[model samples]
Target: MAFEDVVVGEARPYADKVVIEEYDPSWPDRYRALADQLHAVLGDTLRLVAHKGSTSVPGLAAKPIIDLVAAVTDSAAEPSYVPALEAVGYRLRVREPDWYQHRMLRKRIVDGADENAHLHVYTEGCPEIAKNLAFRDWLRAHPEDRDRYAEVKRELAKREWRYVQDYAEAKTEIIEDIIAKARAAGVEVPA
Candidate 1:
């Protein structure tokens, strides 16, 4: 199926089934360790090392993966940072110049292995980061909404998908809608 064809309502069957382990209280520690590793390599090139996505939200059921957002001041000028990140096990996966010039890298389990964690690098003050963080925070505050999302994800994991990215894009609509509610409630949408 095409990327846009994967919606939360329809793509539930194709997502990989991930057992919802008990919310790890140590997720913060994980983020800190990972963040330190990132900072050690990038140093001044790193603008922010934020714990983002479902893992960053307490009480949320995540796929045992830490999602990080690293903001750089200027992506075009920071070519060295990409190679630096690659040296530390992060492989560039997605580059979207049209979408806020966003760049994404994923940490592989081993050489030529599937990704275990995702690091999203963007120019400092990128609007996408705000929306992402806001969505996570909003879900943390709303258990019913969070539960609903978890249900969709769990169901989606049972289906068949050509690529994992397709499964992720499927959740975009619900995510965007929840983000809208978050913005309406004055949850601090970053400019």
Candidate 2:
């Protein structure tokens, strides 16, 4: 797929399907390359740019998409950053003011069929920001939880779903349980 093929709000016939893959050691390097792309467009506007989610964990099985978190000045003020990101390859497809004014963008043509990238945007100090980072860190440090999460995702990926988001939602129970354990162990999970 070309850069233009994944443009914002475009309908995807197979968007609901989920396919998990084994750990790829090169994910971090790819993440850094994408970060470079973001920095070129966002400049200093981005407060934090990080690779999060299952793909960020070294041994975790994931849907082969890089999940990135980019926290900026004010996500609700799309005028401040949306256009610039759109100018690059990212295509903004989700906006939710009610939930920390979060936004999600995608640059799907990363490495042919083997890889893709998804950017999750949030304003500074959004609770979800900490959760995302903390979850990744916890899983990275705890092989048990990481393996469990991978297993959960592997099972969920096979279920029927109306949308890809539903597959993500199905992993919430396991995710939250793991997060709660992390917090209890003093992992500093953000509120």
Candidate 3:
């Protein structure tokens, strides 16, 4: 099913679960190590690779997942990068061509525990890339926004959710608000 087909609160037999964790100082180091591995695998195929999400922020609470956005020449061309990524334990989980041709890869679980990392692949210049980067920066620079977002996330995390995407979509309002503020303040949007 496409992203649009995912309804909020609709339970599925097998849905991706989420786990929010306290902000950890080691997150950056973890991201660096994972990015290094990815770089070694992806080499020059990635146009841009960055750590996004609240985990990337200094004090923001997050799901303990290192959200990395990698802009590829063409995410639709999964064959170009999927094999290399899989060879190193990354498994392509979601392929949504309907949504900016986005592709999500999760690191294979070592045992029963989650891999704690997700890599989102997008075509160069995808608008979602800018929005994610902008929100991450905005939260980093504004303590008030960061704290507020953290509160909202913590509150939302407490409730039962069908799919992780539903929990994510629930944050759209606050995300849009921050993006709107960024736009008003002359922040650049991805072209």
Candidate 1 runs further than 4 Å off: 1-22, 112-115
Clashing pairs in 2: none
**Index of the highest-TM-score prediction:** 2
lDDT of 1 by residue, 112-149 (tens): 63446788888898888877787777888899888877
Model 2 compared with the native: what TM-score? 0.89
For 1-191, candidate 3 gives per-residue lDDT tens digits of 74445222333433445667889999999889888887888888888889999889999889877889999899999889999988877777777777899888877465333456889899998999987898899889999989988888888887777667778889988888777787888887553
Model 1 — which ten-residue stretch has the worst lDDT? 6-15
Give me the candidate number with maximum lDDT: 2
> Order of all candidates by lDDT, from best down to worst?
2, 3, 1
Clash totals in order = 7, 0, 0
Rank ordering of all candidates by TM-score, starting from the highest: 2, 3, 1
What global local distance difference test value does model 1 have? 0.75
For candidate 1, the per-residue lDDT at 69 reads 91
Candidate 3 deviant stretches above 4 angstroms: 1-18, 108-114
Q: Least accurate stretch of 10 residues (summed lDDT) in model 2?
A: 1-10
lDDT per residue for candidate 2 within 37-122, as digits (tens), equals 88888887888899998889999988878889999999988888888877776777777766787788877664232337788999
